[model samples]
Target: MSVGVRRVAKGVGDFVIEALGEAVGEFVLSLLACALLGCLVLVAYLAWSFSPRLTIAGAGVLGLLLAHGAWQTFRTSTKGRRRGLATLTAAAFGATAITAIFLLLYGTGCDCW
Candidate 1:
């Protein structure tokens, strides 16, 4: 291929990659999701070990996450189905966390919401 053609191809490739990365949030979303999940795990541990009071806090945070997931899942103007899928996944995780919190509370004879 001609050098000019190669240059154009390389430039197009670079532009497309950068555009997609910025539009899709590259790895930023992944990092935030993983961090949130890690925190949930830590909180669950703390609630189980230190005190059941932390379970109340976990329930509140998980409820927020669940609501966000529901909101995203119901959005109509997103560019792609990935957004809905991610939110649905988040909703599942939130429900699981909430269940865990309830179980801990039950074990403690609290049954707190």
Candidate 2:
């Protein structure tokens, strides 16, 4: 094989590896993901902290996020998903959100908890 072809193949391989590792980290550290992570951490802390109102507000924020995700999954321009799959995924998210709210309202009543 030519040296140029060999170098190109090596470069592509390196890019793929970096994409699987460093690129993912870069994206996670990017503004949007970083801000969302910060919000999630704050919500978690609020839910665990010394006030019932904060915990309730944290759950409300989570419910809002579920609604946003569900809306995103349904919005054609934003979601970029096909109709059938989008409906299926939206339904799944709705089910998951319902189950989560139910659990939040009522304990499992198990000793493990």
Candidate 3:
């Protein structure tokens, strides 16, 4: 290939690599978030199994954490001007609400002492 063509191809290759790197970073971050959420759920379950009071307390703490995380996500999304992040934050908020409802219902049924 000519010198100009080689330069153009190199530039295109660099652009593609940068884009792929960003995509992989985003995917890894998403996976980590999901894993963290799963760990939170597991801890809550263990607390519930050990004691009803602990379950209630754990739920309260988890709710607070979720609310804080959602708020932070919202702020970051807004400031960073990312529509996808905003959508993810909205989904997180919805999931938090649903989880709170389930925890409340579960707490009412527990008779552990």
Candidate 4:
């Protein structure tokens, strides 16, 4: 209604908009970084999968990386329940990856039957 009141409201609106924009930007950047990292992992997996000698070692390293990433994520997470769940999921995935590597190495020849 009043000129002063209108100005104050406009300033507050601008501040809120700027803050939201920043939050969204951060979220987008994080997503992009995750996507890039996933791509790198996929490339590494492909490269290793093609080589019989490197497959086991590569998978083991990847599993370790996953576990470490999970630990870091858990440490940084703000929500307790989500942190616990994410950590558990990461651990499970890492364990499965490592187990698969071992199985692959122990099972029949690298060449498909």
Q: After superposition, how far is residue 48 of candidate 3 from its true place, in Å?
A: 1.0
Quote the lDDT for 97 in model 2: 68
Reference-based TM-score, model 2: 0.30
TM-scores of the models, in the order given: 0.34, 0.30, 0.49, 0.45
Kindly indicate the candidate among 2 and 3 with the higher lDDT. Answer: 3
Query: How does model 3 score by TM-score?
Result: 0.49
As for candidate 2, its clashing pairs are none
lDDT of the structure predicted as candidate 1: 0.66
Q: What is the C-alpha lDDT of each candidate?
A: 0.66, 0.64, 0.68, 0.66
Across 3-97, the per-residue lDDT of candidate 1 in tens digits comes to: 99999999999999999988677345445455555676787887778867777777787677776676665667457655555667566766766
Query: In model 4, what lDDT does residue 54 have?
Result: 85
Q: Could you tell me which residue pairs clash in candidate 3?
A: none
- What lDDT tens digits, residue by residue, belong to model 4 across residues 1-113? 99999999999999999999999976665555455455657887788779967887777876776776567555755655555556666777666666556445433232222
Candidate with maximal TM-score: 3
Evaluation by TM-score, superior candidate among 1 and 4: 4
Per-residue error at 29 for model 1, in Å?
0.9
Prediction 4 global C-alpha lDDT: 0.66
Model 3 whole-model lDDT (C-alpha atoms): 0.68
Q: How close is candidate 4 to the true structure, as a TM-score?
A: 0.45
